[model samples]
Target: MSAVDVSLRRGEREILHGVDFAVRTGEIVALVGPNGAGKSTLLAAMSGDHPISGGRVEIDGRPLDRWSPIALARRRAVLPQQHSVGFPFTARQVVRMGRAAWARTPRQDDDDRIVAEALTTCDVEHLAERPFPSLSGGERARVALARVLAQDTETLLLDEPTAAMDLGHQEEIMQVVRARADDGHAVVVVLHDLGLAAAYADRICVLEQGHLVADGAPDDVLGEELLGRVYRYPVTIGRHPETDTALVLPRRPSRASSPSAQP
Candidate 1:
């Protein structure tokens, strides 16, 4: 079964213009771009949360619309950029909800086991009994992630999962995501931190103003020239001394010469 094909559009907007990409088994693809670049829109379309105005989204070589809601939930898990629960629910209760895809009768011991593993994986075991609303932003983010992890789907889609996290928590989340990819799950993450993307992503997909400007390995996609064109700023790209990964540094925008100074 192929991973999936995700595309979307809006009236006259055309958020995603037939963006074609694939996620192989056991690979982590990071989608990076500036604001309003359609990163979140693409993720929404892929997760079945948003209707595609034109093209379709597929999973395992079949159209996503063909799968029943529960079937799709069982096959793919999504952690959105924002998660809020108005109803007061304990963290454990919320995390357990991820198992809803598999809960045909009642909560089984296997569900508890998976929830425990997910909580530990996301470092939220200590907060399992706390109310979801009482936890800090970072803690709540971790709990939200734990919920998705508990789903135990073959594919995971995350949108800015670490945006509200601390450095340590960010590392923890990235580590868990990388481990998931290593375990043969197709993982897609929308990351604002290019450094983190470079460190963890198997490939980087760059978007600019709702268009896919570049899609390739970090070395090729994150070149200085491409970065400058997409971001409209001067930038430098070099290899990290410690990790040998691509490092990007933004420079001041170059000034345009006046018409009279064209020579």
Candidate 2:
């Protein structure tokens, strides 16, 4: 999927300012920026959920408007930032809903198998029988991810898939994303954790105040000076001992210089 010079307006205020972004097959592109930096807005535009006042979104070399809803759903799946299920449904049932787009099609017969595979891939198979609402935040996040995976689309647009999870689950979700990208799927994820983005993502795109500031491989785009300016805080980047990838950490003020230590 590709968003060419996309600009989106919410009412009178514009959220995204002509951002050009794309996620190619077999690539995991991580969108990283500070809060209110228009990451989610860009993702919405890419998914066709929000209207763009200017520019176009294309899928498989065709404009987003040219494809039918079901046809689009068959090619790409979006997991929005806010996913809530009002109905009382079990995890399995919730996941099965992803196959709705394929209903009445030949793939309908493979629903059960596909859903099960998605559940296991997301590490939520154990929660398959549990009520979605009753599950904990992390569990719900995983189950929601499973639903998206069950859609079996070639492109996966995930918005903070690990926001509510613990460290273990966070790593698990990243692994799932990594596997998907390795499997020749296009994956775009919004992440606040720069370390994970550097470690797992093939490319990183930085946005500030709705503008695309930088876009490149992790080593090229995740520089300390650039990130500090974008995040409005000092940062330090180092190489991981084992992986040799960039490891990003905030530079905190020392106690002697901190405000709390002032007279």
Candidate 3:
């Protein structure tokens, strides 16, 4: 899937400038940026959830608008930052909804198998019968993820999927994302954790104020200069001694030394 000169505008305010990027099959790309930088907005546009004011988005060389809604849902699945059904639904029922895109025939056994597999893949099999609204934040997040997994789309777009999870759960989610990419699906995720992005993403695209600032390998895009410039903070980028992955740490101002003391 690819974005071809995609630009989105909400009224007079533009959310995404003429941004161009692509996700090759079997690769994972992470969109990293500060708040209001249009990371989520860009994903929404690419997933056909938001309309573009200029340019067009194409999936497999075909314009997004040309595909039927069911066809689009089958090819690409999106998990927004927040989801709510506003009613009590069993986790299994919620997951079954993902199969609606392909449920042309009455096949209960197939649906059950798909839902079970999705729950197991997401490590939420125990919560399958629980009501979605009654589950904890992390559990609910996992259930939501399982729904997307059940969709079995070739392209997956996730926005801040690990925000409500703990460290362990966060790592688990990243593992799931990486596994999906390894299975030849294009995966694009908006991640706030720089370390996770560096570890999991094959490429990192940094957005700044609705503009595509940097698009390259994580080592190049997550440098100290880019962090300090785009995030407005002094940050140090170093390699993890054990895992050999990139690590980012914010540099604190020295209390003993005043800014005026420097020549």
Give the number of the best model, judged by TM-score.
Answer: 2
User: Of 1 and 3, which scores higher on TM-score?
Assistant: 3
- Compared with the true structure, all predictions reach lDDT values of 0.86, 0.93, 0.90
TM-score of 2: 0.96
Clashing pairs in 1: none
Model 3 superposed RMSD (Cα): 3.2
Q: How well is each residue in 1-263 modelled by candidate 2, as lDDT tens digits?
A: 99999999989998999899988999999999999999999998989899899999999889999999999999999887776899889999999999999999999999999999999988888999988989988889899999999999999999999999999989989999999999999999999989899989999999999999999999999998899999999999999999998999999889999988999
Worst 10 residues of 3 by lDDT: 103-112
lDDT of 3 by residue, 8-47 (tens): 9898898898999899889999999999999999999999
List model 1 lDDT by residue over 97-148, tens digit each: 9999887746355898999999999999999999999999999999999999
lDDT of 1: 0.86
Show the lowest summed lDDT stretch of 10 residues, model 1.
1-10
lDDT of 3: 0.90
- Arrange candidates, best lDDT first: 2, 3, 1
Candidates in order, TM-scores: namely 0.91, 0.96, 0.94
Could you tell me which residue pairs clash in candidate 2?
A: none
Residue 196 CA displacement from its true place in model 1, Å: 0.6
Any runs in candidate 3 off by more than 4 Å, and if so which? 105-109, 254-263
Deviation in Å, model 1, residue 53 alpha carbon: 1.9
| lDDT at position 176, candidate 3 | 94
